[model samples]
Target: MPEAVAVDPVCVAGVDGCKAGWVAVFRWVGSNRASEVQIFPHFADLLASEHEPRKIAVDMPIGLPQRIGSNGRGPEKAVRPLLGMRQSTVFSIPARAAIYCEDYREACSAALAHSTPPKKVSKQAFHIFPKIREIDQLMTPELETRVYEVHPEVAFWRLNGQEPIAIPKKVKGSSYPAGLDARRDLLVQFGFVANFLDQKPPKGAARDDLMDAAVNAVIAERLLNGDAEPFPTDFGRDERGLRMAIWA
Candidate 1:
């Protein structure tokens, strides 16, 4: 008999901070099923949770090239000469890759097609790239230290927004996809993902959990494919070690 290789377990988490609730789906790598569904009070809870993630894939921005709009000082100013005349989010390395990638484009397009208000859906999806950069720029070192240290809250806020952080109730439940049908389209992509994991295409409709799992799965795919890297510094080596990457 030949020896069998063991599949390493990878835990995947998907975070969606909706208008009235935040939903998270955690899945183990070896199986096609999610290990848990965590509905938290707010986005902070998702970040502060005691659970340790071996390989995290957050659907958020990780970094932004600093000095884009700095006071035309220091290294930022010098880099401009090297970067040429044009600099925008769309042209940034990460954004360019994310927007053009076949899977992400298809997934985003599918989301728009299903949405009732395609414009709004398209706007939000389109914002992810620049927002990642924006958040990284807007978040202060002091605030970052107080909350996440170097945890990449910038990316989190870019995807979920700071509103959820301020107004916890806005994103706290089951009826997350109530009136916004277009936004629901984003959820639909997740549904397709869950079905794919289950080895069955979506029959007719899928649950929000399935959709969340799908998003997590996409993040997982990106991390393995080297779309992102882990943050350099550790927040602290505690019972809950620092998250290496926002999307890893």
Candidate 2:
């Protein structure tokens, strides 16, 4: 007699930060199809709404550092080799003291004082400080265990058979995104419909935001199944006690 295949329902989400708010993708475990995808202005709103998932995988750095130098955090260091050409996507997080600075000068000063080698905050890293600070404050230890930090590139790399995609995310000649169709195609192989990519992103939500969030949601399912793994296995905690690790 043939063995029976088991089916069970699982609910999880992936979230990405965007201009106006955040984009999220929600789906059931072991299925390619998404239950829903939407954008929310605040993480709190997302949590309060009916779309809440049992676990949320987000494309943001959760556990922050008290200090750093030329090298980034353990999880960030761990992903670059696996990502190859796309490794530049992993921006190092600034010191915890840098998150509250009012301006670039203040941030630079804070970084130098707080970091081990007296580092300065990168313009790019500083750009996301608002989001990082927001999540840092919102995530109390009690509420944070359910939220996992994930990198979309790492998730997609795993989806693409552990090989990094050669193409850049944006168009060669223009800033508009390319390879979205191809990404959506790869996602379809996982069980989502091609039309899943057709959902018009909210104003200020870039196309990549939707794709990034969707990939996060997919990885959340992987985490539930125990298929996902954390980087650097050796994780540390911030002053507030939020763990610093990334899952893929």
Candidate 3:
């Protein structure tokens, strides 16, 4: 790879895993126009070739635990009640060991071995295992300090003045609308440039992916500004010492 060019110092970013790899949104401080909104095939490639933002909020769980509670981690547990009807969007991150398993059967077996009560590995979580493991392996002390875990719904709820949006992101009828416009409107009001949301999503970037990434960028801004809130202020770290808190 060529030498990475430096990005704006005031830039903040959000990343969402996409079918093609990752979709990201970058925004500079004090302006509505986004610096970038695109997809990259690998998380590391995105960071290396793309302009480096000061902080990046990503819609992925970090800090996998060996054991799970009745409801899961405090941050994961806290979100369901807060999201109300839209809670299922959040997938539980399984034990760190389960991520290394190659198949669902192996993953399930591994989950049981690692947890006291044993956890059933979901097909959804299994599908994202590759992406999760990618982040888990790539994270280091220096990178962990800059990148953080965030949930789109949590970030959106926070953006809607601490209220969840009434519309579901993936609507069942009428072209399967993801209510991207509704989210865009709210984000615009929150301070994003109006035109950025108007841009068509690139190929393989689902509407939800774009919206999710955008909110994460906003969270990055609030995080540095000391205005963001973390779930389960009392949190723990992963085996490698990665923080388990979810910021919104």
Candidate 4:
């Protein structure tokens, strides 16, 4: 008899930023089960971890532009109308120069200077600047071949047969149970087991964060199977030649 051999499971990840850090859900290839759930304080650390997922679908903006056009970084503009009411979840990312600024006011100033007819950074967009900057700093054309920019609402829109979710996952900054259940039901239809969907979120992550990450994992599986499509079919590139397109 041959000695037992260890085999590493082929996997992909869906990541969402949380209050504590990044919450990543690892799903095995060719299956719906999530093999692991983790929270990493830094994006780089997740990359360097042992899992080495074949693809990473993250709910963060990538491919920052040097100059902005009327509709934001192209991907956001392309996907917004598809999302209907859920479109608000996609924030308009400003120029790379603006994202590097240490202060919110400075970032707004940079955005105004770099955008056409001038635009100011929204407080909501400003809040996620840190996570955006984190991925931007590490992204390269080579790395981007595996890491993809994804928006949970956009993913959900795709999951829900191209229809925008009828409910908002959050209302007035509080999680809505009905909305969460609505999404969970959709995930179930798409092959996720109820046990995984109902599991308590790891520390530092909210229930919504975990769900968002889980949906991203679904997109990751799509990407791996070559079943996913990018918004703005033509896509865009940042100064460093990183591709900018939201995948679903």
For each candidate, the alpha-carbon lDDT, in order, equals 0.37, 0.81, 0.81, 0.90
Query: Residue 227 deviation, candidate 2, in Å?
Result: 1.3
Error of 4 at 233 (Å): 0.4
lDDT for each residue of candidate 3 in 74-178, tens digit (9 for 90 to 100): 678877788887788788767887888988999999887876577778887899999989998889757876788899989999988788887887755232355
Cα miss at 11, model 4 (Å)?
0.2
Candidate 4: tens digits of C-alpha lDDT, residues 5-109: 866567899999999899998888855455678999999998987988889999998888899988779899999999877888888889999999879999999
Clash totals, every prediction: 9, 2, 1, 0
Instruction: List model 2 lDDT by residue over 200-225, tens digit each.
Output: 87787887888888888878888888
Q: Which model, 3 or 4, shows the larger TM-score? A: 4
Minimal lDDT window, size 10, model 4: 28-37
In model 3, pairs of residues that clash are 32-193
Q: Which candidate is the best by TM-score?
A: 4
Best model per lDDT:
4
lDDT of 3 at 16: 94
Clashes of 1: 9
**TM-score for each of the candidates:** 0.34, 0.90, 0.89, 0.94
How does residue 9 of candidate 1 score in lDDT?
65
Instruction: Give the Å error, residue 51, model 3.
Output: 2.1
